[model samples]
Target: MTVRPASVDDLPAIADIYAHYVATSVATFELDVPDRDEWQRRHAAIAAARLPFVVTERDGAVAGYAYCAPWKARPAYRATVEDSVYVAPSAVGTGCGAELLPALLDMSRAVGVRQVIAVIADSGDEASVRLHRRFGFRDAGRLERVGYKHDRWIDTVLMQWSA
Candidate 1:
């Protein structure tokens, strides 16, 4: 498998992968599947800001993807970043997020980012929680019932990694 910077061509696959989570899981609180045009806008925003947006491919198929975005709008938060990672269901347990995350972290560090944050949607998301933990992220905070999805209230897990 290989991980590399993502381009517009990869957006459709990315949208498909994320749409599943949106439609079937609470991994993300999004209730609507964003179209490729929305993905294009997002990709453009990430690129305009020079953030790291990458994808991992296995057997010539996109197995997963990850990216780091500015933690907040304030200049004071410029040194900190928030990370998002998702592995295609077919590639689950293949260590896709595990492998993809570190690559993003490395790129973030190289760009002088001093910290990374992960806002996991559900505290019960063991795979994502475990993946971030394995990458040295620690529980920084938690918000109870901060999100309502799948016809139930859900909590948010906040994990952080500092340089």
Candidate 2:
């Protein structure tokens, strides 16, 4: 597999992966799956800001994607970024996420980001939690019942690593 910067052409595939998560799982809190146009707009905004957005390709097909967005709006919060990763369900557990995350981290650090944060869905996603922990992100805190999805309330586990 190869990891590389996401381009405009990759947005559709990225949207597909994200829409799957939004529609079928509690992994992401998005209640409504967004359309490709909006996804492109959002991606364009991030790209314009030179944020890190990466895709993992396996045999020329996008298997997963990872990106880091500003955690907050203020300039004072500039050094921190929130990380996101979405692997095509078929690609999960095959090291697609494993490869994508390190590249995202490296890119974030390259751009002078000092801290990276990940907001995990819930305790049920043990593998994802372990993945972040493996990359030196510690369990910072958990906001109980912070999100509602899939007919139940869920927690958001905050994990962070200082780069």
Number of the predicted model whose lDDT against the real structure is largest: 1
TM-score of model 2 relative to the true fold?
0.97
TM-score of candidate 1 relative to the true fold: 0.96
**Backbone clash numbers for all candidates listed:** 0, 0
The sequence of per-residue lDDT tens digits that candidate 2 reaches over residues 1-163 is: 8999988899889999999999998889999999988988888877876789999997798999999889999999999999999999888888988898889999999998999989999948688899899888999999999999888999989999999
RMSD of 2: 0.9
- Give per-residue CA lDDT, model 1, range 42-138, as digits (tens): 9999888788999999899899999888999999999998999998999999889978999999988988889999999874658899899998999
Collision pairs in model 1: none
